[model samples]
Target: MNNIATPEQVTATALLLVGYAAVILFFVVRGALRIKSMADYAVGSVRFSPIAVGLSLAASMTSAATFIINPGFIALYGLSGMLSFGVVMPLASMISLVVFTKGFRKHGQTVKALTLAQWIGSRFQSTGLTRYFGWLSLLLITFIVLICVGLTQVLSNALNAPPLPVLVGIVVFIFGYMMFGGANSMVYTNTIQALLKLVVAVVLLTSGYEHFSQGVHGFLAKLAAIDPALTHATNPQSYLFRDYFEIIFCQIVIGVAIVCQPHLITKSLLLDNERDVNRYLLTAVLVLTVFFSVVFAGLYARLAFPGLQLNGQELKMDKIMSAYVVREFPVYVGLLVIMGLISAGISTLESLIQSLSSTITSDIIKPLLSPTVFSGTGGFRREIWLNRLVITVLGAVAIWLSYDQLLNAKLSVAIFAQNGVYAYFAAAFVPISFGIFLRDAPRLAVTVASVTALLVHFGVYYGRLTPYMQLPVRNPGVSAALGIVAAVVVGGVLYLALHRASVPEKTVAVAA
Candidate 1:
């Protein structure tokens, strides 16, 4: 394929990136000064405005998948993709976020939980369960790989550089600073990234306004001219958007559970006051609504690349957004959008690095070798350094996985990410739900539910038990939805059975 970026654009992007790195380093240094302990590192010592934390939540929640990769799906599949990604998914996630944040924050404050695993372990009073979640959190590395791939695609296309070196550079820079900054620097950086993304979202949405000169119908007519399937509510030709089940039901299920991720759910813990929760939710929901709409820009990209080819080479799904930005915009505007795309990836990448490293350090390693290995002031400092080491190891793993996906993706890295990430949240859905909602929830019930979710999700996907999985490219959403449903059923039954067994004891005590 031809280089989409002009020489001037490449030079400008390099300069823009250098300046971005300098700004990030300034914040990382500033935040590092306040990190005297792991608690400070995980939750931050600085008191931030509710609005800023809200913006951070928004930026963290809307990753490159929303801005870069999901748009590529929309570009390929059209309105069906939009309905699943832009409408149904966003609507469900926003509702779920609002519902879950308050209760989660209340409990998090009571237990002083740093990670999701800690929160679950503390709630159930089980050290073993905490360790289990710590190990299970490794599944999120797939998501880190997804973001790395997305950022590499954007940077490579904008800089007119090769993909391999670009991927390595991204992992090193982001994960390196993340080792020190943790939540302290992350909020400030995420807030800034969120604002830039808002502007870019508008620019991308309007970039194709000329396509609608004859009105909404005219835009659809244009898409229809390219391919009739593009204008359909469901694309029979596509793997993910074949019917309403995939477009609506499965998306709704996934969206509701998606917030269970460590980075997303634990964001509420950053709020120091209960009153801030309302304002935080309001800001996040409003900002996320706009960010999610950026997927509609895929429709714009489809119009730009009518044949999905640039200079005789067919565009990969992951590269579509990058190619669209470079081909459609002037150097200065394209550079700005490139920064926003990078910000989209970095905001979430930082959160994942902070939360995942913290989990491995505090929940996994510290618990395994506590009192014995981490007993004094020296051990405390050692834990902080150990967190950095975890980040370095994660960066190495991300580089390897991201490079493989860049070269040999089946369709999009989103599928691989969703498979792993979906199973995580699917398993987490029961434990977190029971922890937050039920006062006397049985740990065994939630544990069994979590295990069942993992079994069902992977079984349906690898076992090809469903028609959706039987396709050449299976839908992770199908497996995830089924897993969530099975978990709920199993957990609910066990919870009821346990409750009934305790009723006789309560009745006899009251009579005595």
Candidate 2:
């Protein structure tokens, strides 16, 4: 591929590219030689320490979306846009550390669960639905790949892609790296990438802080200059306010699923012990700090170019941060920013691919390998080889899908899937937590959780609050919040009912 980038930019990006490749390659070779069984392919023999689990968990999730776009959302909606993440993430971290970690270890089930759909089905005793979820999970994963391509475009646009062949080759290389090594290697790569993201974000923030002195104050002045209603964040007097809130939960659907996401779950499951959850908490804090710092750079751009507004029709707000950096920074610094986005993008892509592939094989494929005929160690080997094959095949499928629908699909679907990932786990999180702590919690409660979360998704998301009572309610978060309440209400009520029913044998004792 012919290099289109200025030599300085190319050298900077190339340095990052080579460094990341070396780390992942080492893991890939180590994993292949060491992995003789299917379990090895999926989970690292479930021997990962808390540090690895926490760091890996953090690395896997701090994807290009956060590195590239989420902070900008914070800038756009102020703190309101951050609500979905702000509300969900801390809860998610806790759930991973406290509630869900020990169960995988106790169940002695395979740890590297490939797809949440398959994992949930298997956990709930619905194996037949495995592939159905495999298909849905693939749908979601393809959405992620599209985001990867879109972000690649944004980055290359910043670098001013030298040519089409080079761009295509760049995408192919990132995909190929993950396909070769799978999740284990992706973990190592993500760790390195996550650190790089922090460094780049800090550098830009330190350099750019002077530009956005007014913060919210400056934002108000700019908003007033542009249009007076910017202060009324909640008022639907304008199209901008109306559309922003309307489409907010459109992102949440997948955000809810994020917790249940195969790759994210692997981070929690692969831990050595409960002690390491704190490390994940620390990682989460560090990542968000850097993320916000980067966004502030764009916010500063607002101060520098007070008239700056992301044009929805011709330009993507998603691409603005990169654009700002490229426009402002000299060649070398600009190169680092592009490389950071690429690294984050590649990390997210690899995790989704590896997790999806592993889930299909472990949850959907392995069980079928010997449905009525349970085999021993050799069976695991046969199934694992099948997993590697599944990885190759599905990775290819994702790439093809990316090439086809990758460009045309709404960035929101990918962003929504990326952001709203909390739903998947929310459906599963509370029920599982209750089951662990409360003696009276019934299995039916778990069922209620799954159903209510799904319904909540529709009701809050589609403006259908209740079958009988629909209002002009604007809270996009209401459905998920209420769904959680419904789960607890139903679960709690059922527990009391079951408890009361079991307590009334005093008179019967006398009769006996």
Candidate 3:
């Protein structure tokens, strides 16, 4: 387990991954032909089965963060991490997905919206608001950086290569193809990735079965023997799982709103009919249930490395899972898992590139510069080319940020991503919620809510406003939850007041 990867191991992993990348490129090429317009690239022109879309959703939702980075948290702090990530968060997110999907899709489909910003803009009847959201969507590049770093970690570890080259290569390859493929190839690649992930998830989860040979209590005893805090329901020593509030309450609230993200929520729009909704939700929820459970593999990882050290060096919070795979699995099994991990990272990365690039091109650049610049014979074609150019720029940004995060991450890149991602979804939660449930939502209220979320989230985190934030390992979830609460409260009050005023005016006008 302590030995470094052999030459044979490195070569085999590289070959398998190259083959995987080739297959993905093939799909991208096929899908590129079908993508003539930006709309097709945004949501795919073909009518796909609900099952395939569902699997794509599952894949996109459970990314490198779920399969790679999260297990490291569980390995560090045992039961508390499991409860928060494996149970509470997933439960809330799935329920939120089911509750929000039908409403969002109905509205999104009706409006012909391709991006979350476009959907928000249409819902509020404000082009300016949509433009603002388009700018805000740039925050998601942080998440793309996260996946890049996670993938780099897995590939670097497996291939025994330096991380920088791997990081550059990954960004170039994935984002390169993504410029043309978009949603059509994205869904196809994601379905295959999801199936691979399903097998790997099973393997990681079951790999730890031997740890429970003497049953649940015995398993707990082993953790307790190493570090008593590991078996605790709430790990007071850990920043994220300090108390019930941080572990359960904050995570659940964040989870409920997490589906509001562009990549996650807009997924339902890929389906062509209302009848397919139920099957899509069913497939997604069922597959994700198993995927989330893979966090429990961290507990097994902890059991394997009692001191959390390898080769006489302290294991990093992010590298524990990679080390575990190398130390635990045999060569062939390790290769399979490595491919799955690569798939896991790439699946979500593709979605992010598609969603973010479309948002930037359609919502931001098109609105700002299209009338002035795109006034030529091949304007429509130019717009499509513009989207590709945007993807290339995004790739460069991802490489830069990912390199910085690789060198200067606090605990893991997960935290960096969560801070940016949580702020985004927190702001999005209020508008999307009101847009779906409340009729005639005042634009002012939605604007106020969105601004409030961004301010509160960044303020709490950077200001170190909370007791939790004061800890060495801060939880972004707490700040984001507070931001969402503030947005709901402020936006709700404003909406109600505006609605009341308008109601009386309409009544008087009718009487006249």
Candidate 4:
């Protein structure tokens, strides 16, 4: 737990953070000036290049989990964790992203949807379902907590500062600017952050090149020498990656559904031109492929901290990457890596704030209050202010939850995040999938499917229905995958039955 960052590193990081803040504010102010309506706030008034939007999507997709947290899991469980997180998951998600983006965007543009809930409501013609999803989006607070904790870990270590003050500063600054900037500022900042992350990814991936002095076999031998389990494809000793079920199957299931999140899937809405979709997807997948490989740096960290101890204190899974950067790199390089790590967290955090607040304002609060309170031309302006207020409230809640996770994570914040975020997308998958792929999607069928997903996901998780969930450090992926499968089955059967029932009615009407 000792501060491994030297004075030079700390000072340089402080200055770099100041510069980062200044640049972010510049964009926020500029973006704020262009905002005249909720639509502008949610999707932006400025025209953005496909490449920039793609980078923003990549940055949003790769959160603190990819850069600062998941790598720690790899460091602990080695190749097994890497396969689940770094390989299988990425491939599944990228494919899912490409598959879902076009259809989702097509409908979204048709409906002029500002949030996922609106998209769902427009697709199924259900206001109740939209409000339901708007409320359900609160579950995303868990993900916000994860990013905050991850950023806190990196900044606290880099600044040689206490975690509490660091956490407070991060919440205030990020949520503050996000209030005004919304999507307009987010895309620009995310693009810059994405570029920085790309540089750091290369630096981190190559940082361990010397470990392969003899060959690839020799590099792995170094791991096996430390522990044979580290070299195994499935680690019997580990909680998450004990077998192919946990390592491969569950990850693929979770990965495909992962794109259903508001921040990730709804990113397609930012592109004004439909023709840019392919280019955007290409940029995101390629950049994300590189970002995902950053998990291998965990192996390098394990090599560096063979005992997983720094200054006689054991390293927490969440702090391993921060410790690795500070200890392994020189002052200047360490500062640069620290900035990249910060960027990784901030990029997604900004997107979450924008998307979630928009949901709360446009989808939830505005709808409920519109008849009485927002029944005029000035309603849009008031709604924009309300969105800012929502961001402020969200910032406060985030501070509370993030501090709790920072202090009392079971294994890592990733688990806490996965439980909530997994359930969200699991529930969302059915409605979104049906809306996109099926022409005559029945509202009742999708609603039943959505509720079933929530029930089954939390049921299997908290009820410990599966052997996987019975473990002390249970895998959320198990519950999420089961939930998605159950939802699809239930929704599909109901849709076919309803479709068949309506077909005979159509035939009778034609005869008449």
Candidate 5:
């Protein structure tokens, strides 16, 4: 009844994972040698190719959620989950990435900004706002927890390891190495991970092909036989995909602004030349299309377990895909899939640790503790050491949060992650948009917009102000979308009014 791996399969997966770790460690150590200062640690010293950066972007953006947790959602909610996650979200996010990357990177590279907070502060010329965002960056720790839980789920299910020990081992190994290697190592590892993920994506997407032997309609019939809602575009009984608004509109809005995050946007800054931007975006969008499609594998899992049980044991949403992989694939193929899932989780985890630690060390801690953190020129050996200390603290925090989410997740850890992650990008959306497009945006306008987004997003969710949120299951994406819309409207009006009033003062002073 239990979802478990056989001893032979577990041994094979563990051995492959160990080999994978050795290969990753080799690359991490190689990249760590390049890290002589905080700058190098933050953005890397090596001149990486556009294709590699693009692959890294794909890998980082499509994390354990796409490969692991999302499938669980699809398995649980059926057709509605697929439409929302696989179709609506991917279309919006890819377009947003292509649209936002050039403008953000142009400004980021011009100012030599290392973090998202730095980009905002430099763009708007507001130290207070930058510091505020640096503190707000703590919300992203929730996402780190999601990835940690996801990695734990995949490993525990595959290796037959207890959750606590597996969780501790994962935290220590990943966080310990992350302290030494930053962006330089992250890009290298992520690129390799992306390549492996591509292979697994094909394997997973095709694994369900047999179910379609009776044609598309037949496959639908099979799903409908299990549960009629499984074939419907809208599952009224489910919390997440109950209506068109939750499935499509909310996802589209959130997707458009999702690029505002540091890990996703700052990826463009890694490229040395502007000409390579097109190639980078092209490669990323193409690869991500495949990565996103991997969510459909959940439908296959559902078909495999029509009753959602093995013997008499019920399958948890988060463990569905892990259990599916172990039950369906051959030992070698399952091991490859497990490695791919691990790669998917660790790729983004590395980026989070890199960006968040740098944000804490460079923007928050240094400003508060000592003004001369990076000092004259680039003699930042002290800053480099400080960054390692920051990573240690972040690692500890990640462990604490991950443990809590694993034990007390509501349905799945994705909700907890989405609540925090969505709120962050919602707050960031207004300022980043204004900074990129509105040349004359006053600091007051951007600052108010950012603050308003934070208030509106959290207010709607916690207060259950919106109808969508009042339900037993609430969608954080709805709150984020509404907050983004509110911010744009309020901030736009304020900027226009402020700009109109300030113009006359300049003219009067010149005439006098």
Candidate 6:
């Protein structure tokens, strides 16, 4: 079952591994000496260089789930899957910049300000509500971290080996450096991993295209011979328009919901200046453009190896590149592909853990321990031990969840870390957007934003409503869109009514 390695493949993989290890070690040493205080642990100081912040932002957004699950989905669906759902990055990132950057970074304040709840708490001037939002975020982030790590096992199966040890081994080694290096470690490691993934994908995909394109007529004939069903998306109706709209609607909801993501937003409030916002945005776009190359290559693989299959499934359409790469490429190329996939997976997983740490410390642990948790924000310069302990607990729980999902519920394999966060964001986007920017938005509007979003996201998702289920285009996105519209209409009317009721009619004439 193994691809018998030549000295070259082994040496290349070994060198790549050694290089990755060195990167991890470098971040680890740097973190141990300089990082302290909960603020430093969570967001790094507000003084992070423009490049570091941009790279860190890119790394945070490109999680292990993107590296692993997206390729698998591509195999199952097509390029349209990412184009339909994953294409929300520009919309999401821009909305994040516009909606949150002003509030978080307007004054260069640095606090744990990681999740949307934190922002809501900060903006509206409420502690109790903030804590509540924080705890909820903690639960979601913890789930995300566990799922991301468990995915390494899927990578193992792709490599044609036992997966548990591989999953656990990598998690431990990565988490060690991750904890010590904090945000810095996670960002730096991801930069290296992002570069590796881009390279491996480019080289491998180019080889595949060149090799397959040699006799297009012949290959086309062979492909048509393999799966005419794939000649075009026959099942597009089953999931296309429905899935497309479902994701889009939810994307709109989640697009603004990014305000809730503490890890992504934590750095926003700490920026040195307003001009840096443009620089950060550019970095995000550049990194994502490179990452999208991987997505395109994966989609193209489906086109190139139309007939390439193992046990009736096309190898190119894998959740992990290791399985497909080994089947599609030579032994030497497969090794590089494996290393690249692992690099992407590990880098994203580290960031997920970091989010988990910040969530628990700020959301669950600190709120319960010290009521006035956000008193000062030169970044999390207070409560070092509290932060680490909470992070450790979060890691332990994630390990347990990963173990359970691996042994008991295999379906957990499909749980994507970012997609779930996207759900959270999508649910909150519209309401939050209005509440923050619209002066006419009353307290009732805030209430509507929060309540309507909750109902649409959880209610439709859980089958509490019949109409949504009966509809042809029922999905998270559609449901979220309906929810956002309803909230806006209701909230707007409520705000208008409340304002009119409070004001004196004669006062207007007196002023005139």
What are the Cα lDDT values of the candidates? 0.93, 0.54, 0.91, 0.93, 0.91, 0.56
Residue pairs of candidate 1 with colliding backbone atoms: none
Q: Model 3 lDDT vs. the true structure?
A: 0.91
Query: What tens digits encode model 6's per-residue C-alpha lDDT throughout 1-512?
Result: 33324455556655766776786797678765667566566655437666666666666665554555555555445534555445664466555655565655642253435555665666555675566566556536533554445355444554444556666666667666666677655656666766777687577547556535657555445445555433342335333323444445555554555544556656555356677877776776677656645654545556545554545663433333444564566766676677666766666566667766666666667767654554566435455556666656665666666666555542224332332454455445543565456655565556656667667655665563644455433344445555656666667777778788768765777888
Residue-wise C-alpha lDDT for candidate 5, range 364-396, written one tens digit per residue: 988887556467765477788788888888888
lDDT of 6 at 440: 55
TM-score of every candidate relative to the true structure: 0.99, 0.75, 0.98, 0.99, 0.98, 0.80
- Residue 306 displacement in candidate 4 (angstroms): 1.0
Q: Given candidate 4, what's the lDDT at residue 371?
A: 68
List, residue by residue over 1-512, the lDDT tens digit for candidate 4. Answer: 48888898888999988998999999899888898888999988898989999999999999999999999999999999999999999999999999999999999999989999999999999899999999999999999999999999999999889899999999999999898888998998999999999999999999999999999999999999998899999998888999999889989999999999999999988998899999999999999999999999999999999999999998999999999999999998888899999999999999999999999987888876646565588877778789989999999999999999988999999999999999999999999999999999999999999999999999999999978876788888899999999999999999999999999999999999
Question: Listing every candidate in turn, what is its Cα RMSD in Å to the true structure after a full C-alpha superposition?
Answer: 0.9, 5.5, 1.4, 1.0, 1.5, 4.8
Which 10-residue span in candidate 6 carries the lowest summed lDDT?
Answer: 410-419
lDDT of 3 at 286: 99
In candidate 6, clashing pairs total 15
Between prediction 4 and prediction 5, which has the larger lDDT? Answer: 4
Query: What TM-score does model 6 achieve against the real structure?
Result: 0.80
- For model 3, residues 246-299, the per-residue Cα lDDT tens digits are 888888899999999999999999999999999999999999999989889999
Model 5 misplaced regions, further than 4 Å: 1-3, 372-379
lDDT of 1 by residue, 1-512 (tens): 46888899989999999999999999999999998889999999899989999999999999999999999999999999999999999999999999888888899999999999999999999998899999999999999999999999998998888999999999889999998888999998999999999999999989999998999999999999999999999998999999999999999999999999999999999988999999999999999999999999999999889899888888889999989998899989998899999999999999999999999999888866757566676876888999999999999999999999998898999999999999999999999989989999999999999999999999999999978887878999999999999999999999999999999999999999
C-alpha positional error of residue 436 in candidate 2 after TM-score superposition, expressed in Å = 3.3
Query: In model 5, which range of ten residues has the least summed lDDT?
Result: 370-379
